[model samples]
Target: MTAADLPEIKILIDATELFPSSMLGEMVQQFLSGNEAKEIWLVLTNPQSVGVAYVAPEKLTDGTFNLLLIAVHPKQQGKGSGTQLIAEVENRLKELGARILLVETSGLEGFELTRRFYLKNGYELEGRIRDFYQDGDDKVIFRKVLT
Candidate 1:
């Protein structure tokens, strides 16, 4: 996606309960200005509405890419959108010299579905960061090595 995509993508973000922050707006602006992936993939349902994945390059100790965020609308969940988004992200990352993709998710009880979704998308359980999310929430880190 390009700069033209942002104004509409903001609408999709607004329709969701998960992303109610104006920081996202700022992030997208920065992303468009070159702080993010060379290309963005979207499950676009309208001009300014979409489910998105914000990718960023990273040099892991092993050197790879990190999919910073893989977000879908609550209304757009359970329709293979997450899997599709991962596939696109991986493909784009590979094209950009990425050899692996690392992702992180919260392990809150309420996010069990989020955890499983990553596993289902071919990410392996790598490790965990205790209390990474808060007093009672740990962060689960997962990774998929691209071929």
Candidate 2:
């Protein structure tokens, strides 16, 4: 995605409860500026973007990549769009010599589906940080090793 895609990408991000709208601009800027570790991918259906995935390769690590942010439009949530986008990200990361891909999500009731999605997609539970996000919301990390 290009700079012109930021607004739509922000909309997709906003539709989900994962991130705050205020940080969208800064995040987009960071991706656009060619940060060595960061990469953003957009899923477009026609002229409108329906999904976004923000990923980063771990610096000074042995082929590790992080799936930083991923969101699909609310209207398209259960229709395989998210899986397709994730598959694309994994393919690209593998091409870049990534051996392990990690993803983290909130450990709250609201995020159960998100966690399940990762598990369903072949990711294994790696670890969790207690009260990482707040007093109750923990951070659950998942890892997938590329063959």
Candidate 3:
């Protein structure tokens, strides 16, 4: 997506309340401008923006792609949008010769569905960082072997 799409994308992500609205614009700008990462993908539903996925080759790692961000609008949750987005990403990563795809999320009550989604999609828990987000929130990393 382009930098101009950030405002609407930020709104969709903010609806999930998974990230701070203040930080999304900068992140989107970095990816869109190719200032930090290589590529990003967005899923739109007609006139409205519904989902987004950002991915980049891992630094110092061979054939690894980081699934930087993936979010679907709150209203569109459980409708297979997220699943389809992730599947498309896997296909693209495979085409790029990536052997592994990694995604990280918070270990909080609100993020249980996210963790489950990854697992249901064949990702395994690879690691966890305690109290990464705050005093109680942890960072959980999941890895999927694309081969």
Candidate 4:
């Protein structure tokens, strides 16, 4: 997504509960200096943005990327937008010669659907850190080798 799209995309982010809506501007601004594809960003524009994603190279690792955040508007949640986002991110990373993509999510009961989404998308259940987010909240990591 481009700088011009951030305002509208922020709505989607907020709707998806990905992060605090207040932080989007500060976060996206850091990646917006016009260097193309250094970070893989995408927004699904079905009339309006229904999804958004951000990916960055993992520090201290060669060709390893972190799918830092991805969210689809709640209204569009079951409409394949999320799958399309993942496919696009993978395709873009492959073109960039990336070797792997890692995604993390909370392992709370409320996020079981999210964990299943990753598995359905071919990500392996790689690791889990108990109480990483607080008591009874684990950090679940999923890995997809792009090769």
Query: TM-score, each model?
Result: 0.82, 0.90, 0.87, 0.95
Residue-level lDDT for 27 in candidate 4: 74
Best of the two (2, 3) by lDDT: 3
Lowest lDDT block of 10, candidate 2:
36-45
By lDDT, rank the candidates, best first: 4, 3, 2, 1
Better of 3 and 4 by lDDT: 4
Which model scores highest in lDDT? Answer: 4
On residues 27-146, what C-alpha lDDT tens digit does candidate 3 reach at each position?
Answer: 666666677655656656546788888888888998988898898998888999999889999988888788999999999998899999999999999999999989999999999999
**lDDT assessment of candidate 3:** 0.85
Write down the worst ten-residue block by lDDT for model 1: 39-48
The parts of candidate 1 lying over 4 Å away from their true place are: 34-48, 59-62
- TM-score sort, best first: 4, 2, 3, 1
CA lDDT, every prediction?
0.72, 0.84, 0.85, 0.90
Task: Please name the candidate that would achieve the greatest TM-score relative to the true structure.
Answer: 4
Q: Write the per-residue lDDT of candidate 2 for residues 59-132, one digit (tens) a residue.
A: 89988888988888999889998899899999888888889999988999988999999999999999999999
Error in Å for residue 56 of model 4: 0.4
Query: Which runs in model 3 stand beyond 4 Å of their true positions?
Result: 34-37
- Per-residue alpha-carbon lDDT of candidate 4 for residues 57-138, written as tens digits (9 for 90 to 100): 9989999999998899999997899999999999999999999999999999999999999999999999999999999999
